[model samples]
Target: MVAADRNAGGIRGQKAVFVGPHQLLRPLGEGGMGQVYLARSPGLRLLAVKVIRPEYAEDPQFQRRFQQEVEAARRVTGFHTPPVVDAEPRGRRPWMATAYLPAPALGEVILRFGTFSEAGVRALGAALAEALAAIHAAGVVHRDLKPGNVLIARDGPRVIDFGISRAFDATHLTRTGMVCGTPGYIAPECIVSASVTSAAADVFSLGCLLVYALTGRTPFGSGEPAQINRRVVYEEPDLSGVPGTLRPLVASCLDKDPARRSTATTLLGALAPVDPGALLSPGLLAELDARERQAEADLAAPQADPPALPVRTWQSLSRRGLFGLGAGLGAGAAAAVGVPLLLTRRTRPTGSAATVGKPVDAWGVDAAGTGSPPAGPEPLWSKPITGMTVDHQLSLLGATPVWWNEGMGAVGYDGTTGRQAWSREDAQFFQVQNDLIYGTSLDFAGLVWLNDKAESHRSPLVVPAAQRDEAAMSLRVFGADSRTVVLARETSLTGGGIVAGADLGSGAVLWQQEITENLAVSLARHQDSMLSGSGSSMGLVADGRCYFEDSGVIHAVDLRTGASRWQATGVTSAGVPSRLLRTGGLLLVVHGLAVVALDPATGQQRWAAPATPQPIFGCALGAGRLLLSGAMGTAYCLDVTTGRGSWHTTVGVTTAADRGADYQAPSAGEGFFGVPLPSRPSGVAVLDAADGAIRWVVNSASDEGRWTTAAKGGTLYCASATTLRAFRAGGA
Candidate 1:
């Protein structure tokens, strides 16, 4: 939960910030450990700055061990290692700086592409072996060596996030309850009893990572931490996916008895003389080079304290939703910062849950009113949009429901009957504004617009200076108002991108501005296309100001000029607000369990509101009230205007990783909320919005698998792997 270590009042103490001789630039990311920043030495050399989390730094034993590990890491040297440049383990926040490079990680490559070629895997595996050999030679153990920690640069694979794995060792894992390594790649000894882990633990992790690189799947499979560790401790790996020729070598490294594994030196002897270029495809190489060049160009031209991203992605902050609760595990990621005077304590506020930014005389309470399922009068209709067994996606284009075919375009169904309505394979469904649907072509050369009648036309989406990575362009639609659309072309991972405003109808460019950091793009389950290559939208918009947030800071830009209006900082790094809502006379935003209200024009706080009783996983607002759903099926109702708590209840539900299903904001309607169950047993739990009454519950056919639910107006649409069903208000 430690996001950024904020000492200054807000974002404006920026006369200059530094650690030792390194000048702090912008944030790269944050994790359970601490915030990672992109910095420059007095010599202007780019460096990756890692600031330790307060909780860990505050521990006396941790600070002592951190110094020892830093010293140990400073001794390690190898061709595949990014050398540690500096450290200040006993400072106010305890930080370390390492060499920064423009390489993507093994996991990133697999996600964008697929499996690596055998030769590519061998070359990268060898590079990793060299890194391990050097670390052990320095008498240091890299307890965590998963795909997320290893960087694949133009030179070769470089292992990072070093030395600190044992900063709080096994004894701390017991004293402070720490997790050693990422689930699938963790060595069995590290899990059963951390006392036994050694250089061999690194060897076991390397084996798992190599399997992931070659097969694009973990050898032990992926799931809950305990389940995955159980397999690691007791069962042999499922190496069927690995190349036949390399299976034996990989198996030898994965021996249940850590001491029996091959040494890093032996593996490096085989993997040596690797060709870095062999590990990446030509297309990836081009994209990678372009991104690196962009970063170099940005560094050459220093900004006057411009908002920016990290110079490198050293460690993926998989905790606290830096990427939406599923960072290193995959799914999403983004960071934040607050304004000068707005930062407040993250603990729950004392006001009524129904508290508002300002006093409101009257408001509807439909979100917590007595009600029934929006799509419920029953005789629910079902239809198969396509195949029966692939990962399916569902969203609403106004009242029309659209489902995806993974890589292909999408299909539309009549909301009432689940019957095929109209299909468009040429251009996918994007965003809906003022009853009009907007999308980009498959190649992203033009914009496609569709009317409610399904009639369409194409307009060129002129994106200049955008990088093309094989299938998709880096240009993304920030969002649209009546006349203009906001677009940004990502140039570098350090967040050097170009933003532009264009005429939505003609796609004629109006103005453009170069951005130093990635915008807090407003992304919802179905706001835009679910297609892999289709870019995302910008942050929310209200009162002509496009409100975007990142690093816990909310920024507003004029939609007409693409100019910065104002930045409201002081928001806690507890959690990034998923959606910015415009209700009453305020902008309603929720981060973690806290709900906040800000003035639309000046980004000023009218009045602080109380948060929900538990950590909010999903939420919705209707009839003047906000409904928050937390883990273990706990739900709370608060007045949308005053933030006053009205009701609370627990509707039995599991806290499994259903890939965000159990966390999708509960569907709200006329009189009730429908909480989507995460296939522990696929079902819908309905509760009366008023008084938190348990109305009814209905389970899906066991064979249907996991169900994804969404609501538009008074209708609820739930889609399973093969079938899509529609329901209305009333009984179970």
Candidate 2:
């Protein structure tokens, strides 16, 4: 199938794969991202593959990130994390192949059978403590730890999902603005930024996970993310039912201060009995048994009244005031490193290295390269483009710079000679545009289609002439192939439409399509398929045929001949969906809880997974392996062939905070990093591509330096905000 036709008129193209139907046995469950399926291997070995939400597969950035995370996950050991058996990152519908261990999550066990007794809790706690220690020893931090992440097997407990966790030596994916972790179990420091460190944060999470294992709830109790974050940051955990003997250890682990929190190693030592026989003595066992029964009874009682959540308020007073007002427990505003700046440059001081030479024209040096600009590297080379500006909320397309001007407009530089090839100024007007540095497009028909930063659609061609009585306006047209810019009086919303034709020399428009006063939000295009969406319904063009929806009916029209094709049933919703994405040879319309994937050849149902309207945390797709996010802290991966649960890992809690936290909350500031270390420098390690084994690691846990990125053939550039650094990768 042609890329455009198979897409059903969407920007993303799907890769086709073959799978046996017998691979998938039974359906495990479903959530926001996709479905989990139970599948068996050819040798009768059990495995699982997760099918991703089609919309997620449509996002290139999300897809790349998902692949990176999955690849990194394979490097983790210590028997806590599940092992990845196989994967296909680039596929029609992505999925991961993992060994399907038949262990139930602690949450599932508790929900189905009831809470664990005191003896069981201690044994589980010891096992988990050891597990976390091993994970940390491997230089990993399990950022999200909860009952769901812990599996109960016949031998012991196994932890899963290193998705949110990072190795001690790497630049964190969460970094500045994104906050990741289960709300109820998140560390106190995690609320501030990604600067928090050491295994102590995991220790705090361990406390919460252990509390849930013993009492079947959070230590700080429940609410939305914002509500629970406050309690995690400030309020003391209520251990009313905890036995006196176990209370001390739990409290120590829950210490808000990392220094005070017990190390995973220390906990393991403390768990060891001076005398194992005395651990089961009659008197002691009876006392422990009574406490366990009481706790179980308490757990069974339905909360007569929901625990009172403190009313949160934004406070700008002193740190003490923030604490006093209970605002310290709230989530801090997501922040970026610097302010946003358009295409412009300011000269540095007289002796600054950046200002040493006269600026040259037409430069494009790989930011992901070695520090020394290579011999004959572009004289117009610049380092750290997007990192220089801070606008974390900037859409994925706007997050990075495309081709920008050193002083004038954008210029293209030759890859080999580092010389200016061509430059364009006033070529096209864009309100917001991010360029794609690593994408290719086929020159087909009279169209030069470019898919940059996922959603931006700008066409230098098809600049429509202005009517005498009309005022020239700038229009924002969104679609596949090309977005038209009309400089005509009162042309359309934002003065834009689909480009019919344009003059390259003068940038003039020859033809255009006029959209009615409907609220159009998304558009998709394929070889033989075209789809667009408005507030109430969808419109499509299949094989030169046109289709529109009004009320609850769909009408088809032939675009080539200007005739109608055929209309079918329409979808009804309160408003337009966020956007349309194509995958698995279909066009997908997605809202919070509803999804519809239609065949591009003919507008027919391929698959429709109704939305459950939950906050999606992370999504990934690989061939037959698919990972889906859950409302709770856990995530499920399944096999698409059999549609069965392969594995599940509790990552982060899905909850949004209502009000902002106090800005005055104490910040360790620069002190959080750069502290002189007494031990060997800790660093991030890259893994071998063929196997998930550590290849090399670059340490950054100290007062001396930080890590950053620049493009290199194999070497990745690492830098701090102020200093440029470099690291080498050993494997492909």
Candidate 3:
């Protein structure tokens, strides 16, 4: 038996000290994008760093795209892929780091241990299925899901290397003429059309990956790349040597037609019947068992050299829990990584983690069915949050975001629920024309609405502060004089801010000026304008003029004339525009690295200052203080006029850990709760928003499950997968 270090490739000869603060160890491999170095933090936290290759740095286009991709990748929160800890995409070398796993890729495992026995194959299938489920749920497609991408962790299998994934509804980079994926791993649709929906393409790749895992060969075997392409497009998979239990399922995955292929959900259900042990032939199973035992016996044996890639220690690598006897189709995926790391030649039970308690009620109804559903009662009307739904048509198309009339007000639903408890609706007052509700708290002051009607109200419209779409805002208030109504003008798509006014009883005009277009997402306002987001071309201003951005390219626009701003032809690109803010006679713009104070009167740049995680507005001017949040897990207190920082604090994703964590500021109670990551259990943490400081940490064993919280009567109600817990001020 050989030690893992035998193949270290003269690692000692290279300078070993790490370059990052986390101090990852020296790398084992280098690639086109970056080098993969192993390292550890002071507390023995292992990590992998991908340092960008120098040649790629010279290409500005690739650099921008890489930065954007890294940001998008980090936003994906789940257990399947490695999480980003620190990134320096703009640094001299540009690198990103993630938690490291002391495991081998499926490719390495197969090479070292020979081919997988039947049981090992079954477990591998299951793990892959679970990983895909999570990845897809995040609206991302792994484009590449092959053996080399699967990592076998000690406790389970993990999916990694998302360098080429596609986010749903995002931009595409591969030119029309170029091929985008590994040959064998490419789906038939991708190979044939080069343009398939993200979800469909991924399902196709899953099938191809399963074939390789089960038989140690691609469904379309070794051949010229061109020949393989032809075979993949025309041929039926040859499943000659695959274990019987896995043959049928693997066959379905290989369907030439993408629609005919089984969905991940369906595949997971299909994997249930196969016993992990049955996938292997009897003789091979016996041989593997013997080899595992022998390998263990030899762990202590002295060796002259690290064995080549293919060597196996028969004694030490037992095939016990590794048997995966009952693992279903998902088992193969799980087994592919889970078994290798988990079994450790030792026996342990293997099954999905106890369904995290009676499976979170898919429907909001409780055991009694009478408890309040999170969204509140059957709505007088219903509207979905902009980014909440999986369906994009709700926003891209002219779908009406429903507004409900509740008492004197209206609210928005959290999507599917009907109960009034969790639902949030907007209260209206057209009388207060052009006012919309837009704040983080439930206080009346936080609920004002901006009605864009150009006329005065029928009555004196008086209401709290808020920000909502025209439809929702109009329904909330009543205007008297049709002429004096102050409503947001439906000029064109991407129009500037929501202009405010009082509606005159007459149907004529009222006071109106251009509202800023800094942070608007409404299609009704910004329609005619192409979201001018190309390289150096920031998105269009609300009024359809050119705009500019840092991490995002701002579209060139004439500030004085609301005319279309022309840019150089062929300079096509897109980017996010930071909203403009007014501070102390200085017009402030929040770019990627710092807040630049511009002279609003002349459009001149004034002062630029740095900030942490990039400031995203959280609340309108509360007194003189501005509230904001960042990509990092914290919220900030900034001066509304000076563009100065006041305080910062960490907000839990939610009241409960199981509910998942969110960085949005919590409505101040005894303190605010951070939302938890969905994959993690529910717990609560309180912090000072004035200065990023944790006040308390409470573990919520939520019965509602999935870390979620609700506050009422001065107590924070929390729930997890199994238990429900509560916390309050003074730990009451």
Candidate 4:
């Protein structure tokens, strides 16, 4: 018996099943032609195996066409094209396998990270040109070259999925009245003639991909296929965001007249001078390497035979954890398969000063100094506070609320009564851990620690002006038991930057390391000018190590001796490590497009949860789940262990009224999690910790500002720019 037949027991109806020697781990996508599976060869190599429908395999004409196209695909081997590795055209289930590139699809990358910078577009254009050159050289026309078919590999962009590709001399297999490629990306000539497709058609598609990469949208706009095709054939392509340097070349390639379009070879010549390194960052490359390693490990795992049962029964069993073979088809996986598995302000006081026992209306005055009307439903108590910005406030468990503003240093409010418990007029709150508050003053002179009673602990450390001018500085506290606090002072020098750690409590300099000086200089120079933003540099203290990022690499130093522990590259794009959270022995960082969880002891990646399309606002880990929120009001919860999504919810639309409001990170506890609603009727949203179901939405006392929430001891605290309100869960 052939491998396909032997594996027939694993087959259950139309659901994907193992074919031949490749095990279909999961379905990548499905279309009219067939289904694509992320499969693994018996030798453990990853392959995107496309299996033709059984009915199609039985048809002699389809079989012949599949074989011909597979041969042509095999002949067009290039560094930019995923090579066809194996095929069985005559098997009971015809399938072809190609080297699987684990990187995200080009479309996915753009959606997650936003449109590419000019340099990125240039790099992508050049790589696509090279791939097209190879395909045309083999006498094949890649009829489909949309963003979805292009994978963003670490070394360069890779063109993939030659599903509709054909040799120049091959007969047309597509039926009449059928389009061969995606509508918006299809060439005008291909749509108009409905007959002839040449190498020039691929060029037009390349131009479309470039436009999409630069603008995060298709050139012709998107809609129903027929409408899009008409627009493609008649309207001029939109080159709005295309960088001026490449506009003319892209416009030429997208010309309606196929003869006027630039050929792949000509386009390659135009892109030959572009440097791929300028377009790719070290962090991105490191992420790619990690992903590749992960893929290898996943492939190496032995496959388990599917039990003989009904599809529904198997699904139920899988959900119950009786079987660990089935992959989740949740939002995370859906988003992945769609692409192949893809601020502040505060203010001063005003209003009536309401104390703990006062009515909600007496809680505070507005900017006008009149008694401000209650904005949301009445809470347990509300009190007005004085500050210009409330962006960096801390509400630690079992501690009073700590609020920080540029104008008002740090103020602590009673957790239950909304009374001012303490105030540090000279320091801006940085972080609160282990019942101790940490902050820095405006003069860059020293760090301060305040206890719950408002007692102060000062560490006199000053940053020189020269170092401050060259590099940015930040301080963080982390350790396994939350006992050790390390101050990470990063100095960006000319060639690279220096990162020095000091014991926060003792004011003792721990260790210092110099990082990619040249990269730091480049990043600093471009951060303010580039649309993709500058690379982030920041640090974290966690799990007995002082962790910091510089020029796309994450470094960890031992807390006891300040010795280097380990250095991992590409954990995140250039950005500050805004949040480092530890829960269940996993250390989580909100970076780039993922909420990455790492093993605290070894710095090994445990899993990454896919965040929303927008950048994450903050994240919290509790109830065995990771909760993430974004500016768009979207929230996602992932199982802590597996990183599979448990649920996702959108609180409300972000409004301009709340633009200047500083929202506190979401906090989880007591079977509930609280998220600050930043829209009209602004308030706090309490969600069931298990499934992210909204329990209630308690409107805030002020509608027009960013508000943040924290939950602990059955009390939910909501802080707006001018007011801090406390509410009891279940409306107390």
Best by TM-score: 1
lDDT of 2: 0.38
What is candidate 4's lDDT per residue for 1-732, written digit by digit as tens?
011223322212112244555666544544344556677776778888776543244445566777888888889978999889898775544678999987867755654455678888888898999999998898778888887688888778999877335421122333223566677788998887667869899999899888888886678874346777999999998899787888999999999998999999899899777778755555566667887896876575556443333332211322111111111111112222111111011112122111111111111111222232233346889888765552345454245766564223677788777788866677655455556656665564666777877887776553465443222233333221233455433231112344555655555566666544233223322211111111122454556677665544566778767687776653543322334556688766555235566777777877766433333556665667767665446566677787666665556555433432333467766676777765666567776666555566766445455576666666777777777787776323
Once superposed on the true structure, which residue ranges of model 2 sit more than 4 Å away at CA? 1-22, 30-35, 51-68, 90-94, 163-178, 195-197, 273-732
lDDT of 2 by residue, 599-699 (tens): 65565655544222222222333344333332322223333334333433222111212001100000001101011111123222232222112223344
User: What ranges in model 4 sit over 4 Å off?
Assistant: 1-377, 389-394, 441-444, 462-484, 490-497, 515-537, 569-579, 610-614, 654-664, 730-732
**What ranking emerges by TM-score with the best candidate at the front?**
1, 4, 2, 3
Model 2 worst lDDT run, 10 consecutive residues: 662-671
TM-score of 1: 0.54
Candidate 1 lDDT, 296-399, residue by residue in tens:
86366443332235521212322111111111110111121221111121111121011112212111212232233233245478776555254455666667
After TM-score superposition, the amount by which residue 45's alpha carbon in candidate 3 deviates from its true location, in angstroms, is 1.1
List all candidate RMSDs to the true structure. Answer: 13.1, 24.7, 23.0, 16.9
Q: Each candidate's TM vs. the true structure?
A: 0.54, 0.36, 0.36, 0.46
Model 3, 1-732: lDDT tens per residue?
Answer: 122333221122211133345443333343324446655544555567666533333234555656766776677666667787776665434567777766656654543345666666666676677667766776667776766577765455678866434421122323123445656667787778765656556666676666665565667754234566777888877788887877778877777777787877787787765454543444444545664464343232232233346634322334221111010001011111111121222112112010011111211101111121121112222222222221011100011112222223332222223122222333332212112222211233222332322111133322223322222322222121223333332221112333334433332333333433322232211211111000111122232122443222233343333233432211111122344433355444443223445454445554433233322322322334444444223344555455555554433221212111222223233334333222233344444334324444444333222343333323443333333334443223
730 in model 4: Cα distance from truth in Å?
Answer: 6.7
| Residue 692, candidate 4: C-alpha displacement in angstroms | 1.4
Cα lDDT, all candidates: 0.60, 0.38, 0.40, 0.58
